[model samples]
Target: AGSPTEATALVCLDLPSSQVEVVARSSSVAVEPEYLSIPEPIVFPTGGGKEVAYAFFYPPKNRDFVAPAGEKPPLLVKSHGGPTGATAAVLNLGIQYWTSRGIAVLDVNYRGSSGYGRAYREALKGRWGLVDVEDCIAGAQFLAAQGKVDGERLLIRGGSAGGYTTLAALTFHTVFKAGASYYGVSDLEALAQETHKFESHYLDSLIGPYPERRDLYRERSPIHHLEGLNCPVIFFQGLEDAIVPPNQAERMVAALQAKGIPVAYVPFAGEQHGFRQAANLKRALEAELYFYAQILGFPLAELIEPVPIANWPPPR
Candidate 1:
C-alpha cells in the first residue's frame, strides 16, 4: 500500500500473529542504505482496530549473549514534517550519534501521512489536529509498553508539519516530557489564511476546503491553545522563513513565556524555513540537545555553544 501523492490515507492489512505463517503483507517501497536493516511495521490497537505505525528502533548491541545492565534508554518520539511524509529509516549521521549514545528514537509516520496508500493516508482528513496528535501519543505509548524506554524522559520533536504535531502533542497531551520544533506551524488558521501559492490550497486535503473548514483552521492551531501547553519547548526557525514566518515562532515563544513554561525560541537571522548554514545548523542541533538535557535531567555530553535560559527552573 502506498500514496503516490501527499496527505492521503494509508492502506494496510491486519496480520494476526497467530496466522503470520499463512498471511502475507505488501512490502514498503522506501530504499535503505547498504549498512542498515529496516525494522518491521508495528501495530497498536486503536479505538476498534489496530493503527499501524512505521518506526525504526536501534538498540545497543547485546554483549556475549548476555543482557546489558543499564537504565532504560531515553526515548525521542520523532514526528516528521509534511504531515504527508512517512518516517523511513533514512540514512542520517545524527540518528547514529543518538543510537550510539544509547538513546532510543521512534520516528512516527502518523495518520494523514503518505506511503500507506490512499485510504490510510486519508485517516487525517477533516480531523487534522486531533487525529495526528493521537498518533504521536500512541507511538509513545507503544515505546513505554516495550519497557525499554524511560517513560519519564520522553521527548517529541519535528519540523514543518511534524512541528505542528509536536506542538499539538505537548499542548493536547501529556505523554512527552519535552519537545522541539523546527519552523513548525504554530497557527493552522494563519497558515491557511497566509500561505504561499504551492500550499495555499493544500489545506483542502489535510483538513477541509477553505472557507468551509475555516473554523477547524483556528481550533486545531497550537498558537490559539497555548493556555493549555505547560511543558518545556525549544523551537528553532529561520529569521527569513516565509513558509512559517518569524512571527509564528515569536508568538509561541511569547505564549510559553507568559505561561511561565521554560521555553527557548532561537531564530537564525537571514535564514529561511530550513536552516542550511553550517554554523546555524550546528547551533540549532546543539541548542535543541542542550534544551532537552537541561529539562530532562539527562547526562550532559559537553554542552557545546549553549543558549542560556533566563528563567531556568520551570514553574511547578
Candidate 2:
C-alpha cells in the first residue's frame, strides 16, 4: 500500500532532566573482594617520546567515599605476561579480590607490549629494561596526580615478562613500597645465554643480540641492584618453568635477603612458566595479597594464609 507509507519519518523528542534518573550500579552495588572493581584503560606520556598504555581496575566507591579533601586509596599496578602482552579489561577475580578490599589495581601494558597496534608495541625493541620500566612508573605517577591513589603506597606486580617489569620498576623507582614478580626474568644475560628456543631470539629485539649487548643485559638486570634496594619484595617461580627458570628467583631472593631487604621466594615444584593449577594460583594470589597488606599496612578483608616473609616492613 503506497510503498507501505514509508513506515516513518523523522521525529523529534526532548527529554527533561527532571524526568531523567541516574543510578550508579556500583554506587549501589556492595563492594566485594571477588568482583567489586571496574576495569578501565588509561594512556600516559612516555619520558622520551612515545606514549605508554595501561588498564586500570577501579574499585567501587565507599558510596559515602569522602576523601577528607586530600586522602586517597592505595594502588597496586600490575603488568601482564609476555613483554608482548596487553592487559585486557578482563574480569580477573584476583584484581577484584583487592578492589573489594579498598585497593585500586592498574594492569599496565608497557612498551614492547602488544594490542596497542604494532608501532606502540615495538617501542621497547632494543631497549627492554629502559622504556618498559619507565612507562610503568609513569602510569603510577599519572594515577597519583589524578588524586586517585596514594602515590607513596604504590605497589607493582607482574608475571613472567610482567614480573621482569615489576623487578625493574622496584629497582629503578623509589615510589613503589613493595612488589612481586611471578616467574619473571632477573638476568637478561643468563636468559639469553641459556633459555629455550622460543625466547632465545625474542630478546634480540627486547634487549639486543646476546653477548653483543652483554653490558646492557647486566646493567638492566634487577638482581645486580639488589644491594641498593630497601623495599619489600616477593618472588613466585614455578620450579619447572622453562621460560624463566627458578634459579632466577632464587638468586634474586638470596641477594635481596643478604642486603636485609624483606624478601620471600616461593618456588613451587611441578609448576610451569605460570602457575595454572587452581591451588598454586590461589596460593600465589593470596600470598601476594597478604604480603602487600602486611608490608603496606592496608587492612585487607580477606584472610591471607600466613606465608612468613622475614623482616617485612613494620606492619600497619
Where is model 1 poorest over a 10-residue stretch in terms of lDDT?
1-10
**Per-residue lDDT of candidate 1, residues 245-306 (tens digit):** 88998898888787777889888888987777989877887888888878877666464777
- Residues 164-197, candidate 2, lDDT per residue (tens digit)? 8888888877879999989888887778877888
lDDT of candidate 1 vs native? 0.74
**What is candidate 2's CA lDDT for residue 111?**
75
Angstrom error at residue 75, model 1: 0.8
Whole-model Cα lDDT of every candidate shown, in order = 0.74, 0.75
TM-score of 2: 0.82
